[model samples]
Target chain A: MKFAVVVFPGSNCDVDMYHAISDELGEEVEYVWHDVDSLDDFDAILLPGGFSYGDYLRSGAIARFSNVMKAIKKAADEGKPILGVCNGFQILLEAGLLPGAMRRNNTLTFICRPVKLRVENNETMFTSQYERGEVITIPIAHGEGNYYCDEQTLQQLTANNQIVFRYEGENPNGSLQNIAGIVNEKGNVLGMMPHPERAVHELLGGADGLKLFQSIVTYWRDAHVVTT
Target chain B: MYKVKVYVTLRENVLDPQGNAVKGALHSLNYREVQDVRIGKFMELLVEKSDRDIDAVVKEMCEKLLANTVIEDYRYEIEEVVVQ
Candidate 1:
């Protein structure tokens, strides 16, 4: 399966994502420019982390207006598999792909550290390889990764089973219910504040990120998605 | 013309790490009594539409891009107006 990674001006994880998917996972991967208007060549699209658009007007605020995001929205509406990590997650929230909004880190400093996350749902294509309640180690780097939403919406998300991941311990960023990740109702789009691409190789200290990519490719292969 | 003021804030359950850090720094400096601190965004919008759907348009803006409803709450009001 061909995977496309969206690269905005300030995105720092596109290369890392490309390496993880193409070099390590041995799959076809492409870095799609954020200005591009189409995503017809990719089966799965990844929104990697970093301060998109220099974190102007909020972390993901400016990046959401990039031309490529318009196409991303179309693809998402068409039920294409999409994964957003870190700032990418913020962009998704801004783009309305997922629920909630991101606020500044309560402490107001750039936080860069490894965090433990618990797998909340394994049915989605991104986390199917992980078991429910399994803890995975990944790194989070952001100054605005705090997620928030009102009470009514929170209840709706809970009843809809939209939440998919949570912080394993410490509730690092003060995310609602310790939420680390969430998926849309269709389960094809996922946004999370942790960087899965950063933890794909053992040399990086943990390999928990591999499961996410593996699950994506495996879902396409098993389901015969647009067979070539 | 109508002027709207938008207040954007993080939902209560989410952590405001930045605000907490600032609060801590304030405490260290002997500025106490600040029980909690949270950071939010404020925006002023100008609209020329005279239709009663101003609220709907602003709501759409929030849903489409202005604010993320997943983890944030946003409220707006037409604070001023001139029907020129």
Candidate 2:
């Protein structure tokens, strides 16, 4: 029921993530600086999007070396649910928490708009609230969201149902197999380029992304809270 | 001193949009016979003499920070320099 939004220098989406968890989802949330070494107090870890380390060298490359990443790895090993959106997704890839890497959008442009995403698998802790094959509108904003992995890795992902979200219509960034998001083999860590926190309110455009946050809370309650 | 020149390029299986764009530009300029084009990054590092093996050091640096082995391939040339 508690969330820690990891804040790196140049992290622009930390506030948005905090707002989503606190105001929209009504959950306990706080900002954890990248320098912090431990995340023992938080139940879920959220890595927000931004031009971390100014996206120098490569997106998420420099930020991966931050002190907090070691603790994040520890959290992953403990099976804590971690969500990385946008550049946060890039960081997770660089940190090796998730597979694959991002590349320049095939069109070579920064894309920003709401795109339809099909829920590829609904069994993961993050997407349990979404119905299988359900189409939801989530906004994506990035220039290097083109996800790539070796063929063998792709086969494993497909076999394990790790590919969580796929572009429903046109592949905006030319991601392989229209992959918009994926989860680790354990299914606890999710890295997606689309901004779910940004779409928690209907007024903003759509409320389709709210279920993802709700799903995390549901998973935590099921594991931690005992029924009378 | 050692001057290390590192070159990092996308793996053969990966696509390079920037390189493709540049190739398109060349074609528009009427430069036929240009078979293919690929883009990559170049970096220079000045390393002071150390007890560690230079080749091993450079390789470790490239694998750890300078390049991502998943999607990128890196090569380096070391030039020993005498500092005054």
Candidate 3:
């Protein structure tokens, strides 16, 4: 399967995402510019972390209006897997591809460290390799990773099994319900603040995150084989 | 021409960490009377006269880009400008 790593001007993690996919995952991956209008050639889309548009206006606010968003939304509607990490998660929230919004960390400080996360649901394509209730270590770096949604929306998310990852211990950023990550209602789109791409190799620290990529690839291969 | 001033603020129920920090500082300075401090953003836009209604245009701008309706509420004031 092929992957497209969308890169905005201020995106610093594009290279990291490309390296993880190409070198570690041994997959076909390319960096697609934020202004590009087509993603038809790619099967999966990855939005990596960074302060897109310098976090101007709000984190990921301006970047969401980029020309590439049209294509990204189209890809989302087509049921393609899309994983967003860190600021990429912020963009997904801003673009309305996912629900809720992000707020400044309750401490009003930039947090940069590894945190434990529990796999709330492993049924989705992104977390199929993980076991429910399993805890894994992934690094988080951000100033505005606090996720917020209305009470009714929160209820819907809980009912739909959209909340996929929860903080294992102390809530690092004050996210509601200790939410560390979530997928859209369809389960095809996932947005998480933790950097799974950064953890794809043991040299980086832990290889726990490698399974997330493997799960996506496995799901795609199985589905393709079934249909064709 | 019109000079529009837009103010965007977090919704009432949403937590404002920066605002709370500022409020704490104010309380420490003996301004205990201040019960709440909610910080927000202010943006100024110079708009040219157009066929579209100014109120409608401003509202659309705020709803679409200037502020995210999910967590923020926005208000604006417009003043007609006379350029000699």
Candidate 4:
């Protein structure tokens, strides 16, 4: 499926996302600048990680006001799959596309390493390939990756089964409940701190992340394929 | 002219690791009386006098951009400047 990787001015992982989609996933992908006013041509939206707007005023705070965000919101309203990684996840939170906010890592340092994550729910489009309770290795790199939300919101997330991924062994960033990834109420939008694109190739590290992209493509084709 | 000063800090329920680290350093330095230390942000804005309500304008700025109400709290003060 065609994907659009939204690129803000300070986004450093845009190329990595593009390479993951175009080369590793072998899918059609394009870099959509932050100023773009429409996402009509893309089938899915990918918000890559980086210090957007230099992480000024807070991570993803300034970037949330970018012109492309309006379109991203509209895309979400239209039920198009939207996946946000790292700072992209922070942007989703700042833009109110996802619940919860990111805070400084409990250690107060920039952490960059491969983290083991447990797939909490495999029913969604993003994790359909994985078995329930499956564990996968993905890399996470961020300073403010701690996720915080009110008790009510956390309960709602649990009730709706929106929690997609959780830390397998140790909570590296001190995220609430060890939540590493989550999907919106509608299940079309996902926000996660780990870098799945970075783990798509075994040469780079491991190919555990490739299944997520494959799941999305497989689910899309299954739902959209025309029956004559 | 008007000078607007804004202060932003993490919400009470949120943990401030930097602030905690600083507090620890202070304790090691023998500052025993210190109860707590919270780090925050400060910004100053200069705006030209206009018919619009300055309070409303600054409030909007703080709500929309100056601070993220989800995890941080913000307060601001406006002062009139005299021009010679």
Candidate 5:
């Protein structure tokens, strides 16, 4: 499967995401600049993390207006799997691709460390490789990672099984219900603050995040493979 | 010319850790009567006069960029300015 790693100015993790997909996962990947108006060539989209637009007005607020977002929206409507990590998650929230918004960490500090996440749901394309109720370690780095939404929206998320990952032991940034990641209602889009690409190597930390990438590839191949 | 002042704040139910920290500092400084505190964003915009309704323009800006309606509430005041 071909992947497009969206690159915005100040996106520090774009290379990491590319390396993870191309080297570790052995998938075709390329860096797609934020100014590009078309995303027709890519089968999957990855929005990497960084202080886009300097995180000026708000995290992900300014980056949401980038030209590429329109194409990303179009890709999402076509049911292409899209993953947003860290600042990318913030952008998805600001762009209304995913519900809710991020607030300052309850500690009012930029937290950067490894965190344990529980697989809340294993049916989605992103987490299908993870065992149900399995715990995995991934690194999180951000200040505005506290996720917030109304009570009603939270209920809908729970009912739809959209809550994909939850903080296993301790909530690092005080996210609501220890929510570490979530998917859209259609299950094609996922936004999470943790850096899964960073965890794809055992020497770097752990290879727990590789399965997520593998799951996406496996799902795409299964659904798209044609019989002659 | 017109001067527009905008205030953007978190919704009532949302938690503000920075505000809480500031409140704690005030308490430590012996300001006992402080009941609550909320931190928000304040922006000043100078807009040129035009035929379009100023209120509508400011409202649209607030909704589109200045404030995120999902978690924030915004209010703005517009004042006509007389240049020398």
Candidate 6:
């Protein structure tokens, strides 16, 4: 499958995602500059995590207005698969592809460590590699990673089976319902506070996150347009 | 013109480390009367009526990007005012 990763001014993880997909997974991937007006020639788009725009004007606030995001919004409406990780998750929230806002870590400190996440719903295209309610540990790093949503909306999210991942043990960032990740109602857009790309290689200490990318590849392959 | 003030907060299920730190400080200071503390972010948006269906547009902006209606609640109002 052909994949594209957007590169914002401050996107430090762009290479990581690029290498993980190309060098590691041996998949064809392209890097789209943030200023690009369109997301053509790619099946899936990824907004890898990093301090986009130096996390100024709030983490994802500034990056939300980036040129390519407008294209991403339209693509999502067109049923394209878009994944946002870490700061990418913040950007997704800012882009409104998913519900909930990321707040300052209740501890008010930047946290970086491998965190255990519970797979809330795997029926979606992203996490189908694991059973629903399964647990996996991946590294999470962010200062304003706390997630917030209203009570009723939280209830609606749970009722609709839209939640994708949650912190398995203690809530690290004080995310509502220990939420680590969530998908849009259509399940094509996913935003997670953890860094799955960072955890994709066992040599990196844990391969727990590889399943996410692998799953994406498998799902796209099953759809039959992909070249192995 | 319309002005919308949106306040965002973490839901109860999420941990509030800032709140916890404040609570701990309050107790340490011997001010046990303080029950709890939580922190939230606030945003104010101003849009002109000529900006195209300001109300609907703003609502869509909030839902699409501004506020994460999930853990935060946002309310807005219309007004005519002068800025010096």
Compare the candidates by DockQ and give the number of the best one.
Answer: 2
Per-residue alpha-carbon lDDT of candidate 4 for residues A1-228, written as tens digits (9 for 90 to 100): 799999998899899889989999899999999999999998899999999999988999999999999999999998888999999999999999999999899999999999999999999989999999999999999999999998999999999999999999999988999999999999999999999999988898998998999888887888888768
Query: lDDT per model, in order?
Result: 0.85, 0.95, 0.94, 0.93, 0.95, 0.83
lDDT of 6 at B54: 68
Cα error, residue B26 of model 5, in Å, equals 0.4
The predicted structure with the larger lDDT, 2 or 4, is 2
**How many clashes show up per model?**
22, 0, 0, 0, 0, 9
What stretches of model 6 exceed 4 Å from their correct place? A226-228, B1-20, B30-84
Deviating ranges (above 4 Å) for candidate 4 = none
Q: What docking class should model 5 receive? A: high
Candidate 4 has which clashing residue pairs, if any? none
Cα error of candidate 2 at position A42, Å: 0.5
Q: Is model 1 an incorrect, acceptable, medium or high docking prediction?
A: medium
lDDT of 1 by residue, A76-99 (tens): 988889999998998898877887
lDDT of 3 by residue, B1-84 (tens): 999999999999999999999999999999999999999999999999999999999999999889999999999999999866
lDDT of 4 by residue, B1-84 (tens): 999999999988888888999999999999988888999999999998889999999999999888888888999999999856
Q: Name model 2 segments beyond 4 Å from true.
A: none
Tell me what TM-score chain B of candidate 6 gets against the true chain B: 0.66
Q: Give me the displacement of residue A164 in model 2, in angstroms.
A: 0.3
Tens-place lDDT digits, model 2, residues A1-228: 789999999999999999999999999999999999899899999999999999999999999999999999999999999999999999999999999999999999999999999999999999999999999999999999999999999999999999999999899998999999999999999999999999999888998999999999999999999999
Model 1 lDDT, full chain set: 0.85
DockQ of 5: 0.87
Write the residue-wise lDDT of candidate 5 on A141-223 in tens digits: 99999999999999999999999999999898989999999999999999999999999999988999999999999889989
List A-chain TM-scores for all predictions. Answer: 0.96, 0.99, 0.98, 0.98, 0.99, 0.96
Reference-based lDDT, residue A177, model 1:
88
